[model samples]
Target: MQYAQKPELYATGTIQLWEDPHIAKGMLEAHLAPDNDAASRNHQFIDRSVKWLSTLSPVEAAPKVIDFGCGPGMYTSRLAKLGYEVTGVDISENSINYAKEDAVSNNLHINYRNESYLELKDEGLYDWAILIYCDYSVLSPEQRQTLLENIKRALKPGGKLIFDVFTPYQYEPLKESHSWYAENASGFYKDGPHLCLFSHFLYEDDVYLDQYVIIDEMDQVDVIRVWDRSFTVARLQQEIESAGLKLSAYYSNVAGDLYNEASKSLCFVVEKW
Candidate 1:
């Protein structure tokens, strides 16, 4: 009997580190790994948010919660266990697939949707919305405002929306130019074990750029680029107000401390009118 041919596995999209689905999936999976330090930090942040949610009186019905950019459903599973009806929305199909599989393995029920935040509108369907892990900063200023407006519409009256963004201080230590070079037999591999030469630069305008060249043992090579933007507290606050949401609180740390200039993250709780 003849066997069917298997499909080739290769990076898709712009080949940039941030846009390449394969690399993005790998990075997200690593961060969501249970034993990873980043995962531990994320859990602590979620715990603190859950604690705050606990203080609110139980609604007549369980509040519907949406996790924006919920990569692999790490926090989605936790929120489901807390008795909240959880829905995780992600732009990445690969991420959503992995999240669904992970949720099934854990015997947890979560609604995982492959959709962008821009597509989520206030259908009066959710009581709480979350854009955790500094996901809000992932969008441009215009896109951010659009997302907030959609979240506002999705919430019921007095519903809550919470999100985090990196502060201006996050760019303080990053230099304008940095580079690295390495070589090895495995270095020529583009998608496998390889030596990588990398360079990164942080601009004064709150944008960061990185470029990487991977070389495998066979001398094969590929290049990847990445860019990220940071937001200021004032700008974020203005956007929140423009969305018709009231900023209930701002925390500098996951532990609910007041925001300060030195804080790397700006966590906000906003209530929809």
Candidate 2:
């Protein structure tokens, strides 16, 4: 096995982290972990975020909202409860199923679809489009462009896209590193004994990658690569305007706090031009 080898940029993992049954279960668990920020933000932060989002369009406005990567309806259900017309899209069928079931149990009216947000084709359909939890930072440059275009098409004139991305400060402390471990009990990567090799990489353009190479008892190997591209205000503005959208406002977080250089992440409100 090629241990600690860096693959090409944006190379896909052998197993789809979001779609694979075993990994998806772990991802869902991470998302549901009350205090964990592994997948979704902590519940308290999500509560505050939903409350802040509600204020964007008064409940009386009854605005339409499309949430990309809306895992297990964490934010969608809350927004729906606040009377927004909500539709959630996610690539993980496992997550979508859970979200759909939860919506039913709560008697919340939400449209949940198991599909990549990049496949969104709606044209001028929503008053607000949200991609939270800094999911925007993981996409490749080309993918980011496609996503921006898709979001632009999905929004109505004057509609706003609210998203967040990590700032350079977020990864300031992570240095290039490599490690490995053996697990006999079932864990996040698989259901049986495995040797997991890990590599933390820092690349140009404020990008970082966390790579995992997993080898099972049968010698079957798989790889998972997670990429994060941090951004500055100037870089973000350039990208937003390049997509034919206008950067209306930016903050340190989705909670609408003003941004400062020391902030580790940034939230942006981009309007369809």
Clash totals in order: 11, 0
Clashes of 1: 11
By summed lDDT, the worst window of 10 consecutive residues in model 2 runs over 53-62
TM-score of 1: 0.78
Q: What local lDDT score does residue 161 receive in model 2, on the 0 to 100 scale?
A: 93
Per-residue lDDT over 1-273 for candidate 1, one digit per residue giving the tens place of the 0 to 100 score: 011111122212136443455566566766576556442255555676666654542334545888888877766877777777889998777778888998899888899998888887548898888777776665656777788888888888888887777787877777655455565332322445576666565554586655566666677666665455677777778878887889888888545678887888888888998
Query: What are the models' TM-scores?
Result: 0.78, 0.98
Error of 2 at 228 (Å): 1.0
Error in Å for residue 138 of model 2: 0.4
After aligning candidate 1 to the native by TM-score, how far in Å is the CA of 26 from where it should be?
A: 2.0
Q: Which regions of candidate 2 fall more than 4 Å away from where they truly are?
A: none
